[model samples]
Target: MTSRHLLWSALGAAAILILIGGGWLWSLPPAPSVTPPLPIAQAERDATIAALKPPKRQRPLIAIIGINDATETTDYLMPYGILKRADVADVVTLATKPGPVTLFPVLKVEPQATTAEFDAQHPDGADYVIVPAMSRDDDPAALQWIRNQAARGAIVVGVCAGAKVVGDAGLLHGKRATTHWYSVKEIRGKHPTLRYVEDRRFVVDDRVATTTGISASMPISLTLIEAIAGRDKARAVGRDIGLPDWDARHESDEFTFTRPFALTAIGNTAAFWARERLGIELKDGVDEVSLALAADAWSRTYRSRAVTFAATADARQSRGGLRIHPEQVASDWPAERLLPSVADRRPADVLDETLHAITARYGARTTDFVAMQMEYPRNRAAQ
Candidate 1:
């Protein structure tokens, strides 16, 4: 009886082991393929169908306003440059003269279009007319023509003190505007009827638009595109252009405090310069302590760009009944492509370093720093 039971037990154990071993020895189940299915909607099919569809590049004919030399490097070019980065806008260099107009350097832009030449046939031409601030806005004829364009539906844009020309033409009588900070008081004084605002990078008063200057021009024009077209389309254009913080600041108009709309002449320029180069405004006043604080803040925040300095005689300059004396001028980018030219580069396009240096140096001082005249790099497209 014991031998039989042992035999039965041993047989049962062997049977179980055999089953387990058999299971392990057997081949594995087949795995599913890793290849993904193609997208259901054929982009190529859509492209083929789309290729047959008519072209969609309805570019706005942007005509720039006429001014002798009051025009700025970025003022006229920023929008032109930024917009040209898109397929939606064709930047026609419109000058008072009908031929080639000379700019910062050998950048003699042959006037492809002109106010009189184009305006004669299409009196109500151009989807947009951009006015850049010049050294002076004394052209009555030009101002009159601008009023005519504004009277029509053309969206008028001004950069920095370019708003002064729009204001002078009576376009900004009730419209709110912003300009280069230094000219704020004088602009307000002359155009007393118009409401004045300050310290803003740019302001869009209804259809009318204005920017502080330089880089601010990028956002201002892009916003205009958003309004005319759609936000998505504007986004595409901005992205296509490589404008990094393009639509990032399109904040909701929620309950929030904004900057003051009025400022002192020197304080305004100081505030503007500090924000762009030094990255913060100087400490409240125009005295040595505040100046040092501004320079000190600049050096700390922008250690790479700013240099040490002591206040010099030429560090100060006076404008509109105020004294602006900065201790130093410096702010530099890490880029190696931005040194001044051996000879003025054709297209008058200088690199950005000089303007940055001048801006940093003259933080609360003279408002006249030469700007980086942009030459739209060949085929101005996002890399």
Candidate 2:
């Protein structure tokens, strides 16, 4: 071959090699680049972290037990309302059977779940079980259920006469406990093993806790909330429910009882005409103190024979679960004339305004009667 033909053949061979190398490079999968991208903003990083985080755990579960004709209204409801308001616990009202549990002072409560249904839903049992004061002491099913809950390592709480149920359940044996002052002797006699402690609002022995009176339920519940959700959370809950700086150790005897009774009498008297106008509805209910006051005032009023008093249009239910049926609805009555039940937990300003409004509407005679009733308690306390 000539010199020019040899040079052309060499260029053709070089071109074939370049084509083969390019085909091999194209056949190979692409490799990821190792270079870092632009730095993320701190706010963007935080938002990403928040978005990827797991959800918070659910609140603790609490089960309140009630019985027919035996359960006291306050004992069952106060804690329920308080715990629910706390927003820390999942509180449920349970009973041995379904339907309304007739409470003392003629109130009735329909429990949310039966024992069987509760067990079915929560096979692990409750974290806390509350037993309210019951009139009847011997309920085999209730007693057995209490025992079962205790055996499963759940916290057991008894309020007032509810301590009797715990005692009967055999949980109170060798446990320090207290009950409603009136039932102290009876409870001690019935449960000889129980060491009855007086003057304390509530006593805690291991997982079991017992409180003294119907009203003691509130503080004890706050204590329980403090335990489950920390002191700060409990205090917040207390403040929300109109109790600020609540301490469970504070005994019920610290307050002057006579003043409440006197106020109750006054409230009842004021409610007389309103009751005549509104009528009473026991199914709707009234609190223990309010009910007592109304009853007493009804007995004393001249119109008591002619006019029947009712709690509310729907038969009002009280905080303690007293149900009263009024003969008429108070909706038509003058707003100032309506006797509103003022609980001690109410803010001083709100209470003062409420009192002023009521007295302003009722005239000086009504205010004079209240002042007179109040004076006796002050004098008695001073002495």
Name the candidate that leads on lDDT: 2
**Which residue ranges in model 1 land beyond 4 Å of their true spot?**
1-59, 68-70, 104-107, 246-383
lDDT of 2 by residue, 269-299 (tens): 4454664431222333233333333332222
Lowest-scoring 10 consecutive residues by lDDT in candidate 1? 254-263
Candidate 2: minimum summed lDDT over ten consecutive residues — where? 374-383
Instruction: Give the true-structure RMSD of model 2.
Output: 34.7
Candidate 1, residue 200: Cα displacement in angstroms equals 3.0
TM-score of each: 0.51, 0.59
- lDDT for each residue of candidate 1 in 1-383, tens digit (9 for 90 to 100): 12222111233244345445665312422221223223324453333222222122255567776443334434555566555545456556567765444332112233445677768856756667788765456567678778787677676777767777788878877767776644567678888776765434556555566766444565566665665455576667565444433321211111011111111122333343443332221111222212222232232221112222222423331111112222343343324323222122211122223333445554422212122111111111121
